[model samples]
Target chain A: MTTAIARTIDAIWKMEAARIIGGLARRVRDVGLAEDLAQDALIAALEQWPAKGIPPNPGAWLAMTARNKAIDRLRRDANLRRKLDELGHELEDSAMPAEIAEGIQDDVLRLIFTACHPLLPHEAQIALTLRIVCGLTTEEIARAQLVPEPTVQQRIVRAKKKLADAGIGFNDIAPEDFDARLGAVLQVIYLIYNEGYSASSGSSYLRLSLCEEALRLARMLVHMAKEEAEIHALLALMELQSSRARARTDATGTPIPLPEQNRNHWDRLQIARGLKSLETSRNLGGPPGVYYLQAAIAACHARAVTPDATDWPQISALYSLLFELTQSPVVRLNHAVAVGMAYGPSSGLQLLAPLQTEAALRDYHPLWAARGELLYRAERHAEARAAFETAAGMTRNAPEKTALLARAAACGQ
Target chain B: MKVIVFVKATADSEAAVPPTAELLTAMGNYNEELVKAGIMLGGEGLKPSSFAKRVHFDGPNRTVIDGPFTETKELVAGFWIWEVRNMEEAVEWVKRCPNPMFTASDIDIRPMYGMEDYKEWDKEGGWLEQEVKLREQIEAKNA
Candidate 1:
């Protein structure tokens, strides 16, 4: 019975953390405090849910409990009369229809924007997004961020104070503001997904948990913002990329390039979901955001029955569009590769030449690795070897480092 | 050209944070705006400070600062790189941003070192070659 209760609590936590936090944030107008109150609610559930059995509406129970905790905290503070008065207006006379308070709301969206607010540091935003928005533990977030756990912890603490000081509120974004809000959320989710896809600091080739969390958040966003084509597009992009998780690495955990990955090992379910989401985005009849465009590009690959059948021209065009939209160095780099595949190595090299000035790419390992491969395909073996060697030196990941060295050796062969 | 957009975190270090609906929605909206405006390079929230540690050296002795840090306000949460026209433009864009914290928070902007400052080093072929090579690798890998 206890085991069953524990399992139920786990599920509830996963499904309700965002909602609980969101509701509390609205009440307190303090994300940090809201989270604290939510945790207190979670703790109460942990302690009593087993004995009480699963409540008919677990989310509502949690919200009510958290609300009570917030009230308690306010009462204890003594000088929080203004806060209490506001709460009185917000929560007063409303029926405690446990279902209504616990239902899926826009709080998660609000939380994402708050966590990604301009006042916090980038690292802090990532950490806070994972923790408060995605329900990840600090240790888990630290592992995902590839920073020392303490560093992630400090950033989160500092982030909360920053949020508090900024006085940002938890509210629905106006229709005019929705696009920008969604973009920020997508950026954070994409960052999380990328960190999992190509971890910056960990020894492992992938942290599946981070990827899963990102996908989950993307899915939630899709559900909450059904009218937003880009939201579905973002989810589609993540799902398509994530479908290759099994084939992205070997048994020994070495990285596997897309061309080498066994299509049979790809998760067909995820692919189908991705394709469906892509279709949904397209059907919405609006200019798709960069993620949507990229998802369309990803769909081109997903739809291809074989690697050789890939529509490189279309991908190249799509990437070109992305570059026009964002002009991001990263997108330009990707465009160079797509152009190379669609056109020729010479053309690709020309595209890549200008990106040489991007300072952030200086120590970035993939840049050299990609250059080496392009050089290899162009039959510049010596240069390719040098490029790969350089990449190996820049990267700290053992497997990636080994892969670069092996690629360098192959250039000689 | 050297605009730095501050992105502070919103979780307390010493205290464990659980999610609330309001927080989630705000974060989502804010991130969307940042992306739509193309001001976002990269951003994320951090874990709390207790799990944080800093390595420092005082002369011959090396010191590590373990969290929870004493001052929350003094700590930086997160940041972004924006290639705006100038600091003023960056500030204007920032001025429109919603407050990060539920109470009150500030975002700091700092310019990065530019080519002119690194001219002497560039002449020495410092990291340019490496950068190009890395870019190539990433392209090939992604391709």
Candidate 2:
């Protein structure tokens, strides 16, 4: 019973911590102090809840507890006493006011924007957002990102101090800079999703929790920034990609290439959701952004009932547009695959040849993998085998390595 | 609104043992009811985490860890995405579900965000109008 209650409290903390912090930050006008007050309330719950029964509305309980702590701290500080006066009767109120309660959503949104401010280093921004907005412990953030716990702790500390030094408040960011700030926020979320979607160094291809968190954050952004087409596009791209989680691997956990994945295992609902979001993005006007183009490419695959039925020409066209947008070699590599599929293997090989000496493609496994595939398709068995072996050796992921080695072996036959 | 209902993994689920025929039939019948009521949009069981892996990131560095993770409570056995009117309605529907496991189980329900949640952001003309029209187009295309 004690363990169950403890578990419940922990779950509630994860769900409510962000809201509590957001509300307190608005009340105190200090993000750092708000987080500390919220932590104090959480500590209070950990100590009391296991002994006493859980509260009826744990969220409200935490909010009320944190508010009282804020009021107490203010009363003790002479300089902050005037700020306390500004808090008015809302602090003394027994129940949470309707407006303050409704403002919680806006508070959290503002908190996210503040955390992802362009003033902070990109790494610091990501760490701060995960810690504050996601309500993740430093240790959890460390584990998820594969960094040392102490490093994550240091990053969080420095980030908070930097924000305080800059005198940045929850609503301090200007409307004129909203787009630039929103761009940074979207990039951070996208990076988090990509990390979860494909672990660059891990044996597993996907980390569901990270992906889920990113998707959740993206969904939140879409709700908060309904005017942004790119937000919907990013959400659509994630949903469409995530729908393939099941089909991306075999029963034994071996990696399954896209062409070989069983269509029946795909999550149809997610596909539907992705398509809907994409439609919303397109309807919102403006030229296709990188995310929208990628979603369009993913849509091509999702619409195909069979691999052979895939709209390669459309995908190729989208990738070309994407290439023009980002100029990323990775996009070019993908474009090569689409070209190979749409036209012929030789045509794909021609695109891949120029990329071989491109500095960015030096150690990229997919570049080699694509080269191997194009070579194998061209009936150049010896060259294909060499290429697959090189690709296999480059990849750190076990399942991918196994797949590549198997392809290499197949070339010999 | 849409919500995801997660069925937490247990020791038996972690071991990858097959469910009994009775349990399967019970779940099938329940899913049918959900679909018939248009509550369940989609759902599926997941393979055990032993077949899973984790990749940790430190800056640009990534470290991969194989799974058979010790934390069963944190593991998910299956999940369903359902469209419902509100959290209360979702909870009521979840209460009707047959036991998905041989032992005691826990189900966690979380709300999925919708466009209406951002009504505050609709003040600006251009994009919000397009979002609603596009959503309608998607529904029509799917329909």
Candidate 3:
């Protein structure tokens, strides 16, 4: 019944849900309750909008309705009469706009940080962020993460309960802890992006929608936190990497190597945006951060017209800077790959040699994969095949396994 | 989604009249804003119905229709392609546009079809495969 109205409201919900939820969470002082109130407002919309026709300003309507529900709930349930009075007076408004109140963008940021609070498990944090900030449905998150819908729903429910039990206020963050907290939020967004980019744990090779969702989240952050260099840089990195999406996978979804990918298929529009963002980040410069460095590397790749034309030395230098900053074994591995491209294959092998015994990368398939590539270039075919086979065996992802095995088979030639 | 926003032909636009310097400057600023916001992909203005041709094909026969067609209301004087989150976002952006013509005019937004739109009919993916190849070929030819 009223399928068309319901569908329009669904689209409207995606656009307004986060703001309405965030705005209410600030007023009600509880993320979970705020979300429930927002959902109630949505149900009200579904029940009434079809017969009454959609409102002139739907976002404002939703906000006004949610505010009423919030006020009623506080009056009916709360023992803190004084707190309710303050909220009641503060909330009693004359007029509202489609966007919301001033500093409401802070509520959006607060909502993100609340969802990404360090207390929750990383998976749960990610699940909650997808639900609250990205406004994705439980089913969509489930499909994107390749988990069952009920599992995602349970994860979100548990995360909310954890936040509430811990007495975490939806808009509360110590100003002193702001930078570290923002870093966590950025890290969570990056992790979601990487999960989609490589799809490490799933049967599928790529979740393109996840990548897009991450871009949307990053873009939103860039808008809210305009002064933050890392937010812009993170957005830039995602944009540059996403530009290759069409060329990165084949018809069957097997990954195509960067050197082998067709440049013509790259999204020039996204590359331009990425470069512009990188420039913005640079202008707001504080020594280059992880995202800025990575975005620089991606920009190098984006600028290259052909494989031979790629500025591998600059990429190697950027990776070296990144490794110096992060000191992460993964970054070191990437540095080795970039160095191999810039110098001879032997230099790569030399750099990669220490990683062999490094406990952190002991069984990482990418290390072996890098070794396989370098060894193949060194005319060490048998070693290359063995390394490829090792990588093929170690990887859990099906398409990566297929690609590695194909490499191993090719080494025989 | 990518939407092509068509600025409809008003009588003023059909006459190919130049805009006042102030309006021109405002439009220029608007375009610059679009570029800075990273929404505008590309755009151009038409030279009205003049210097235009339409090839009408029926069966094996082809009829070439010359320019200066009637019905200015249906004509598009210009357009800009923008990548936006949804039609609502597109509409919001269009609402911010300066009135293109000195007189009343209209604009239209139409979403472009991407490869995914054909997914249902391309069960075996042959059509997708062929489309990709065709795209590459066209690009190469144009290049």
Q: Each model's C-alpha lDDT?
A: 0.73, 0.80, 0.83
lDDT of 1 by residue, A1-413 (tens): 77756655765665567778988887777889899888899899999978767776677898899999988888888655575466556545544444333432467767777888756777788899888876677886777666898998898889998876665555534445555666777888888888877742224433655766777677666666677788889989988997776566543446678887767667786698799989999999787688889999988888887798999889989998898899778888888888888898888888888776689678878778878888899999999899899999999988889888999999985
Worst 10 residues of 2 chain A by lDDT: A199-208
TM-score of each: 0.64, 0.70, 0.82
Runs in model 3 deviating more than 4 A are A80-105, A199-206, A396-406, B12-71, B74-105, B132-143
Best by TM-score: 3
Say which docking band candidate 1 falls in.
Answer: incorrect
Worst 10 residues of 3 chain B by lDDT: B114-123
Candidate that beats the other on DockQ, 2 or 3, i.e. the better one = 3
Highest-DockQ candidate: 3
lDDT tens readout by residue for model 3, A1-413: 58766767776787677788999887777788888899899999988999999887787999999999988887788664465455456445423343432333467778888989999999899999988877778988898888999999999999999987786765445555667888899999998998788852213433655776677778777767778899899999999998997788665556778999989889998899899999999999799999999999999999999999999999999999999999999999999998999998999999999999999997799999999999999999999999999999999988889889999999996
Task: List model 2 lDDT by residue over A1-413, tens digit each.
Answer: 87766666765676677788989998887788899999999999999888887776677899999999998998899777665454444345434445433433378788888788788887788888888887778887777777899998898889899987776766555445666777888998988888777752223322445676777778767766677899999989999998887667543445568897768768897899899999999999999998999999999999898999999999999999999999999999999999999999999999889999999888888899899999999999999999999999999978789889999999995
Which residue pairs clash in candidate 2? A145-B57, A202-B64
DockQ of each: 0.01, 0.02, 0.21
Per-residue error for A320 in candidate 1, Å, reads: 1.4
